[model samples]
Target: MDFAFSEEQEMLRSQARSFVTDRFGAERVAQLAETEAGWDESSWDAMTELGWMGLSIPEEQGGAGFGFLEEAVLFEELGYGLYPGPYFSTVALARRALDGAPEQLKRLASGGSRLTLAWIEGGRAKLLPETGMSTQAQESGDGWTLTGEKHLVPDASAATDVVVVAAGPEGLGLWVARCEDAKIEMDPTMDRTRRLGRIIFDGTPAEQVAGAGDVRSTLERVQMTAYAALALEAVGAGQAAFELAADHVKTREQFGKPIGAYQAVSHQVVDSYIGIELARSLAYWAAWCVAEGDERAPMAAAAAKSFAGEAAVASCERAIQVHGGIGFTYEHPLHRYYKRAQWIDSFDGFGSVQRASVATALLGS
Candidate 1:
C-alpha cells in the first residue's frame, strides 16, 4: 500500500501551515505568551472562522467533517508554528469526552464553547485511572459533587467547562464541571507558551458523562489520541529545529568559513535530520492507524510518542548548540522551540512510560 498522504491531506497541511505562519508570527506569539491568558483571542477567533475548531467533528454536528488524519495534519502545523492556546486541550481532549453528549459536541464543534480536560491529579502523569487519583465524585440527588484538587490541568483558566476524571463509589467516572464552580489558579510553567493551572473542586456539582464501565474505554481512546497528537507535535517541533539549525550553520561563519562546512557541525545537522525523519515517519504511521481505527493504534502511538518526544528534545538541543550563545538568549526563537519541546516531551507520559506501554503490548501484562 502507498504510504503517502493523499492530495487532499497535503492541501490541508499546506493550508494549516500558511495560516499559522501568517497568523501566529514569532513576535506575536511571544507577546501572547507573556499575557495572563497566555494566548490571543483574536487568533483563536481567526481559527474558528477557518473552521479548524470543528475539523474532526462530523458534518451533521456543525463541524468540518474531517477525520483524525486531517486533525493530525493541522496539529502538526500548529506545533511547527508553536501556536499557543487551549486548542489541543479543547479539541483533542475535551471534545473526545463529549462523545455521548451531542449538545456539548455541537457547541464545541461550532466553537461556541471551550472546554478542557482536568484528569491529571497531584501533578502526576498517568495513563490509567487506577493509578493515583484522589479526586472523588460523590453521587448527589440528580447530579454528582466532585471534591478534590487537580494539578497541572492544561488550559484550565481558559476553559468554560472542565471534564474531570474522578473515582466514584462505583469506580472511575467522567464528570463535567463548570469552570465557575471550581477555583482555578494559574501555575507557572517552563513553557509559558502553553498555559497550565491547578483546579480545586470543593463540592463542585458535575454531570456524569461516562460511568466506570465505559470510562476506561473512553480514557484509553483519549490517551491514544493524545499520544498520537503529541507525537506529531514533536515531529513538527523537531523538523523546525532541524531546519533552524541547518539554516544557521549554513550562514554562520567560524574561522572565516561557514560552520556547516565543518564535519562536526555537519554531523550534528545530519543527526538531527535523521532523528526528525524517523520521528516523522512514526508519527504519521500512528496518525494513520488512529484515523483508520486499526488495532495497532495503541502500540504505534506509544512507540511514536516515545521516539518523537526524544527526537524533538534532541533537535532543539542541537539547534541551540549550533547557534552558540545567541541560541540560549531570550532574544532568539530557538530557546522557545526548546522549551516547547521539553514541555511536550513530558506531556501525557514520559519516554519511560511510553516504553513500558510498548513492552506491555508486546509481552503479556
Candidate 2:
C-alpha cells in the first residue's frame, strides 16, 4: 500500500505545523509545563475551534468524520511542538472507550469536557484483562460500583470522566464514571509536561460500557490505536531532536571548524536521520492499517510502537550527545525532548512489551 500522504493530508500537516509554530512555540510550551494545569486552555480552545478535537469522530456523531490517518497527522505535529495537554487521553483512549456511547462521545468531542482511561492497577501497566484483575466492579442498586485504585492514569486530574477497565463477577468489563466520584491525586512523573494521576474509586458509581462477549478484543483494538498514535508521536519527537542536533552541529564550532564536519558527530547525525525515517515509515504504515481497519493492524501497531519507541529515545540521546555539555542542562530544551521521548516510550506498552506482542502475533501463544 502507498504510505505517502495525500494532498489533503499534506495540507492538514502544513496547517497543524503553522498553528503549533504560532500558538505553541517553545517558550509557551515551557511555561505551560511549569504551570499547575500543565496545559494551556486557550490553546485547547483554539484546537477545538479548528475542529481538531473531533478529527477522528464519525460524521454522524458531530465530528469532522476523518479517519485515523488524519488523526495521526495531527498528533505527529502536536508531538513535534510538544504541545502539552490531554489530546492523547481525550481523543486516542477516551473517545475509543466511549465508542458506542454517542451522547458522551459528542459531549467529549465538543472539547470543553475531558476524558481519560484508568487502566493501570497498583502502578503496573497491564494491557490484558486477565492482568487488570485488581480493579473490581460489583453490582449495586441500579448500577455498578467500582472499588479499587488505579495508578499512573494520564491526565486523570483534568478529566471530567474516566473509562475504568475492571474485572467483575461475570468477566472483564469497562465502566465509565465521573472523575469527581473518585479521589484523584497527582503523581510524580518523569516528564513534567505530561501529568499523571492516581485515582481511588471507593464504591464509585459507574455505568457499564462493555460487558459480555470478547471484551479483551475491544481492549486490544484500543491498545492498537493508542500504540499507533504513540508511535507517530515518537516519530515527531525524533524528527525534532534530529533537526535540533543537525542545526547545532552545523553552527557549533570545535577547533575553529563546524562539528558537523567531524566524522564522529556526522555519523551519529546520519544514524539519527536513518532511524527517524525507518520509524516514520513503520508508523505511517501502522496508521494506514488502523485507518483502513486492516486485519494486521494489531501486529503492525506492535511493530511500529516497538521500533519507533527505540528510535525516538535513541535520537533524543544522540541529540544530547551532539549538543555536548549544554544539552544536559535544564536550561536546554533538548533534555525536555529526551524526557518526553522516554515518557512516550514507556506509555501503554514499552519497547519490550510491544516486541513481545509482535512475537505473540507471529507465533501462536
Which residue ranges in model 2 land beyond 4 Å of their true spot? Answer: none
Instruction: Report the C-alpha lDDT of model 1 over 1-365, residue by residue, as the tens digit.
Output: 87898899999899889988887878878888888888876666778888888888888889888888989998789999899988888877888777888778788877777888988876556756665368999989988999999989988888888999998998888999999999999988888888789999999999999988899899888888988998898898888889999999999999999999999998999999999999999999999998888999999988998999999999999999988999899988887788888888898767888899899988978
Error of 2 at 268 (Å): 0.5
- Regions more than 4 Å wrong, model 1: none
* Ten contiguous residues with the weakest lDDT in model 2: 123-132
Clashes of 1: 0
Candidate 2 residues 1-365, lDDT tens each? 46589999999999999998898887887887788888876777788888888888877777888889999998899889887888888888877777768878687668757888989886567766555468899999899999999989998877888998898888788999999999999987878777899999999999998885656777887898989998999999889999999999999998999999999999999999999999999999999998999999989988998899889999999999999999898888887788888988998667998888788878967
